[model samples]
Target: MGYDEVARSVTERGELVLRRRTGTDGPAVLELRANGVFVMDTAEHSSEQALADAALASVEQPRRVLVGGLGLGFTLDRVLGDWRVEHCDVVEIEPALVEWMRDGTVPHGRQLLADRRARVIVADVATAVAEAGPASYDVVLLDVDNGPGQLVHDANAALYDVPFLHVVRRTLAPGGALVVWSAGPAPQLLADLEASFGHAEEQTHEVRLQERDEHYWLYVARPAAGRPEASAAG
Candidate 1:
């Protein structure tokens, strides 16, 4: 069992590397690293799938979706499973990662992007959310960083702040849902979501990976009760 360096790139943030671990012990895994920190891998992504599942279930009609991160394409893949999802916009800050995925460095990258319903935007998610029109999406997912506690980039801390959260809220349609994938039970993040959305709850999901148990949190939030009462998109 060894890791083969498949691709490497240095962005303004730091070093990003993609490695392939192959051996008879199990199926090969593709790992992504940012600034020497483990970001995500193709090992166990039940939580990722759950992130999309929980969001989709919250909304009555899920047509336009925006994914904050494109980690191994797990969350996006799960979102597209629902026939109701007409279009999904994926925002990834790293051009190299998107290139790697689209160019087959990641096994399912091409097939995932090839989906006509999906589009990838190479830009900061915070910027994307802020510039987006009001009530533009039915579902907005944030898997950009691990969590507020563990950040791959120092700048990503803004994503969890109250101002940015308000920006996120503005983009969600009436009755829409926003799900943030966190690595830990970030109490501060939960509070911020509650403050911004007027309705926020923490749902915990556990998964076993590399023979160890790990817990992930999804901070599900909706707009305040006093907002307009438009019906979900048909």
Candidate 2:
């Protein structure tokens, strides 16, 4: 009934650990780790849900969507609730995380994973996004790291860079949407998105997990339809 006696399990990675702490608040909460780094918990997934909701709202008729992270499958579950989303491809770098979901370590994960409309890809988000054909997805919701400024992995830093932003833009259909979930406000990343897509907006939401007004920023970028025409005088 207390956090001290919580059950713990060490996955094959050996770097990450999962803990389940029972309390009177609700169901048992799950916690994640990576080489002593605290990843996420199940107490509150507001940002994750918001990431999916914001992306779904921007699309006119989104049939296919790409979710860059599988944290607790909250985002995936929210996305699947939308009947308009016919196909959802989730890209998760950690195989253990995927296995945990399939094995029911994370509640509701098995349901979403078992859904015929869902496809779980065990690969880096960047690679998965690159392999996807241009204009292939109506929306892309990314939550791979804490944020651009506080990345879990160094390689993920490029995800917020210009080159990767272009890849995301190309992968989205005309007028398609891209939504990224950050642990906190990322002004530089928002600026990068604006410069790449010519249209971008940020939405801040409160996450009660930390209980200190945790901020999560959602970056929504809409791809342009056509290239600008050259000036006749030029």
Each prediction's TM-score versus the true structure: 0.94, 0.89
lDDT of prediction 2: 0.82
Model 2: per-residue lDDT, tens digit, 1-234?
Answer: 655322244544446567776764767777776656667888877777888899999989889999998878889999999999999999998887888899887776788799999999999899999899878899999998888978767778888888888888888877789998887789998898887887899998877764566677889998656744222122
lDDT of each structure? 0.89, 0.82
lDDT of 1: 0.89
Worst 10 residues of 2 by lDDT: 225-234
Clashes per prediction? 0, 0
- Which pairs of residues have clashing backbones in candidate 2? none
lDDT of 1 by residue, 68-120 (tens): 99988999999999999999999999999899889988879999999999999
Q: Model 1 clash pairs?
A: none
